[model samples]
Target: MLELDEKFFSRFGAEYSPNEIIFCEYEPGYEFYFIQKGRVRIVKIINDMEKTIDVLGPGDVFGEMAILEEQPRSATAIAMDSVRVLKFHRDNFDALLQGNPQLAYKLLLIFSKRIYDAKRRLMILLLEEPNVKVMDVLIMLAEQNQQFDFESEITLNTTVRQVASWAGMAESEAQKELTHLARLDKIELYEDRIVVKNIRDFQRIVASRRKNLYSS
Candidate 1:
């Protein structure tokens, strides 16, 4: 987890919860550092269709763009579950970043990582898994949440719509794949998590999808 200094937390506004819309497309809001105990969804709507672009969890931070540039949001941020966040206004964030060089560097690094993840998403969209992009999203989630010393059970707290948006697939299709995976004994659903039964199987599916894209 990215540790925030006392100064940052002290100056932050109140915490928020699940299902709350933090920001809307083209709207302005304070920069937020969400320590997601559950899940959060980043959405972008285009041409009248809603697309979920990212599913975030613990240690994830967003809303930096608004504070950095004093510009409107390019997308919408919604809490997918009961969540905790540290919010800072643009002025406070600017002061913090300017005074603490290391903190600024860390924030920049986080930004770079998000850019990298976005590039990976573009690759998945352009080069592979035309129909199974949701699987790719699951694979990414598995990588992030996989248990150590056990090849089984990656715990994820996300919804079908969120996964579908990340994968650029329809929600029904994403649901179908989740069911199929459960039937295949690759994963199992719990009350609050999707337990990955076989990480290798999911990885193999993602690899095969990538290969198909490369060869096509």
Candidate 2:
């Protein structure tokens, strides 16, 4: 990310209230935004249901993919709280990039990272079995969600249904798999959270399961 000065944000920033829609998927995107304050949720519609792809915070830039790819918006951005963003339009987008070498470089890195993250998450969705997908989703979140104080154990604020949504499987299927994992002492499940006993152990389990899935 570029070290954007306060002046750059203050000059072009707009405020958004909590739960406000920054942009919607499939809409004609003519501009992009840089988050100056608060958080934003990146959501995609899957099977007529909204699935949150990611939650982005300050210093992050979004909606640029639409402008860069010259396609309709692929996901919707919603304000998670009181938010401030520096909105940039396409008209002078090139000139802005040409003038700011650092910003251009940062955007390129963001593109690369987003693509890799998308492919990584797709791994769970591509799996054949719900049990395998559930385990894969847990592994994915353990790696991706930085809030976890990683060590011997790490807990996450999530539900089985949320994991199912990410895995693109039924909530019942996710619940059944999660119970099985819990019984195996792989994870500690609660009404609102899950505690992964060890990330490496979880990875090993998922990898073995994935291999068997492919072999069979």
Candidate 3:
């Protein structure tokens, strides 16, 4: 929920239609963007296939790492739907940081959290059991979809292929694990979406799996 102000729109506002490519992997980038509306997906090429790493919505920032490090883009960003974004060039971004200390501090916090999440996902990938890995991914997705209501089910707007990619397993294997969970009344999977029964129960399942992992 970035406040869309008059000055902001006049300076850096731009709109992208659904399925548009915002940036491609390995391309040189000089600007970062903040989503003012809609959603975007961050994807990386793995084994010659595109794997979605994340989905970002309004108020989220992307391409900052390239701007900060002066490096080529690490992943491709594409619009998930009609999107409005405010772009900031590297020099302009530096100027804003110097003038707005609070903005700089907020960006620092966001970057740190992203780094920590990446590390945790890496650790999850190291787990030996496919079921454990899948459960960890589902729990992560559930947490991300959680808002203020802890009692409500979280709906994951994602595909089985993407979940399989995140879990480091084949699509069939992921499907089997998901079916098993459904049979146990743990989750409900639709064509391209999943409904997590409850976040607390999801966490309990993950904790139970971790215990089993260590005990065995």
Worst 10 residues of 1 by lDDT: 144-153
In order of appearance, the predictions have TM-scores of 0.62, 0.80, 0.73
RMSD of 1: 5.2
lDDT of 1 by residue, 23-84 (tens): 78888666656563667788888668867777788867777776658678888988888876
lDDT on C-alpha atoms for all candidate structures? 0.70, 0.83, 0.82
lDDT of 2: 0.83
lDDT (Cα, tens digit) per residue for candidate 3, span 116-189 = 77876875687777877877887776666546255777778777887887787888999998888888887898
lDDT of 2 by residue, 68-101 (tens): 6688898999999999888888886887788778
Rank order by lDDT, top first? 2, 3, 1
What's the CA error at residue 187 for candidate 3, in Å? 4.8
lDDT of 2 at 87: 88
Candidate 1 stretches greater than 4 Å from native:
1-23, 28-61, 67-71, 77-96, 127-131
Candidates 1 and 2 compared: the better one by lDDT is 2
Report residue 118 deviation for candidate 1 (angstroms): 1.9
Off by over 4 Å in 3: 143-159, 183-189, 192-216
Q: Give model 1's TM-score versus the native structure.
A: 0.62
